[model samples]
Target chain A: MNQPYSSALLENAVNEFAKLPGIGRKTALRLVLHLLRQEELSVENFGNAIIKLRKEIKYCHVCHNISDSDTCSLCSDPNRDDSIICVVENIKEVMVIENTHQFKGRYHVLGGVISPMDGIGPSDLEIDSLVKRVSEGGIQEIILALSATMEGDTTNFYIFRKLAPHNIKISILARGVSVGDELEYTDEITLGRSIINRMPFNETFKP
Target chain B: MNQPYSSALLENAVNEFAKLPGIGRKTALRLVLHLLRQEELSVENFGNAIIKLRKEIKYCHVCHNISDSDTCSLCSDPNRDDSIICVVENIKEVMVIENTHQFKGRYHVLGGVISPMDGIGPSDLEIDSLVKRVSEGGIQEIILALSATMEGDTTNFYIFRKLAPHNIKISILARGVSVGDELEYTDEITLGRSIINRMPFNETFKP
Candidate 1:
């Protein structure tokens, strides 16, 4: 019950699986055993997937988002608003914004936020490329769509200061109650901000 | 933000990861991305582990437990009892009994229990090999240590009928209140059985 039987190959597979983030030895054992029962072709395909992902995947040169090619689909799109670039911390954030179908602009992935504890600074991000993209002309608005954390704020301010000299209008996502959020269950800080920054009754209905 | 960029290779990797037992689409993406961030050499090692597991692993011919060789460590050991065999559902159960260090007998893994609903019958298990092992004549006692489920009972009874003519002592694990189990929390059937089959107070203190 506590330990499965001894087999060098089984142990090797379990150890490899356990190396993944958040996976424990028990879960790794379970996963390996499950794979062991599958067809050899399927198991080999699973292995090849990981190997290919590491060896072949490349980041989009324009936005720094993970892609199979040098440039991502969004960056190469002719109809998208290249003038309004949405800045985010990672590629996942790009997906989040894309799901809303609200913004029809390109994106700039910072790779990560500036966290001193994690030794991440302004240089670690793609801020210089963003500034260069703006200075090339025709760019009118840039959206700071990072999270509401301290690191997000620090990164936003750092990019704002760098872009100020280029004379481009910069804006941020509005903070308020979520669309389906109930006031009673909402946290104190978010509820307070939503009340303090309450929009006009007519403005709420306009959108 | 919900839909990550479309890439055939990336989607293939994510789909392969999602095929694992407990993993979902979101978790598969996280795992694939985590592997992507690791060094290429390390990811290759992870992939190779699965390939090696599928290509090289073998099961013990004597007991049906997974092994790196033809015969398992337990079967080859000269110190273990040859007459008494502890019957179990799988290698995990063998490990459980081994951890106790109380039963010094050899084990015979049935591979699985008889389940008509799942299309697993007596033929699916290594029952013929087990009967052959018993007929060879050195087995003095056989302990049935399958789970306390309906399937377990059916398998046990079926095995009992097959081995009846062999004239070997057969026994089942005692069903009673589990150690450290509270009477109030214990199920009604188990409690009643425990009361009816109570061991002598002096016998309880012995081994």
Candidate 2:
């Protein structure tokens, strides 16, 4: 009886959703109230979006990147340079690299990186698939476009080691990317330069 | 014919929307790509929500707050004290005041204040309706819960002068809210205390 203005149900839902990354309680309340102020069609739509996002969306079977279908359109593309595969940390990175219009190479998304602190390790990454893909031949060069981080380096080394025996030319997207900065945060020019100045990982980058 | 990446249309839309106020491009892309990744129901739902929000929601006639109906529930609530109307800058402020549970009074939402630089004036506010509401009344008091800024003070003075002819008990929310601070950022406890210990501005609080 002493409730201030509205339903607790609405407040509870807002509080629950406000816990998402980059969302504050105030912003969450704003979104929730915005939704509440809408017609039932909007409310139903919001709920369906949340539910469908959680249930329907899945990673592409081949690349492990987010996709509406099993094999992503990039993986199925016949024109993309299949002889060169550029590896990235996330699907978001894949888009960033693609937006530059420089690289026509295919992308391999690692789902995540190898960080023992975050409980991510070699087995956790898709290093085996990278190795298998390179061994299967047509791949002439494998470029590592991972972020400049301790964990990103660790993951890169693990992939490098796994592909060492393969006949493909192995290279890492250049060094000017300072440590602690994410690849996603880098501008397109810098990312492009890093890709163009790729170096062979013989020793320093070996796992 | 020359797009290299998988879902170019969805990717571009995600990046554009992410640049908005609170949504980062990653989250924006995540949301847009999430829609692309979903079945038809989810995508349609997201579109429907945006449309319903724009079309179905309208300002309540009495409180001038968002609602599906003519009058907000607060204005129609029989238990709410109609004689005491607390005036606030925006609907967000209304929620803050309501969260305090201290005021059992009705509300008059001004929409915004008299900022001549931004080209807003008294006529732009719901001041005329407030004057009419105060004029027709069993009203004992009109509490001003405006922000303690230059523009807020200006708006308060304008309202005070308009409602003064009615010879009603007119008070403003305290200066306890520090100089150059918005009403929204003030905590509930501080805001509630400011309301309870309000000051009567007759001639001294003017420009």
The local distance difference test score of each candidate is 0.89, 0.73
Poorly placed runs, candidate 1 (over 4 Å):
A1-4, A205-207, B1-4
- Residue pair clashes in candidate 2: none
TM-score of chain B of each: 0.93, 0.75
For model 1 chain B, where is the 10-residue window of minimal lDDT?
B1-10
Q: In angstroms, how far off is A128's CA in candidate 2?
A: 3.8
Index of the highest-TM-score prediction: 1
Worst 10 residues of 2 chain B by lDDT: B1-10
TM-score of each: 0.94, 0.67
Q: Give the alpha carbon lDDT tens digit for every residue of A90-193 in model 2.
A: 77788788877768878888867898998888777777787777777898998998987888888888887788777568888766566678988987876787
TM-score of 1: 0.94
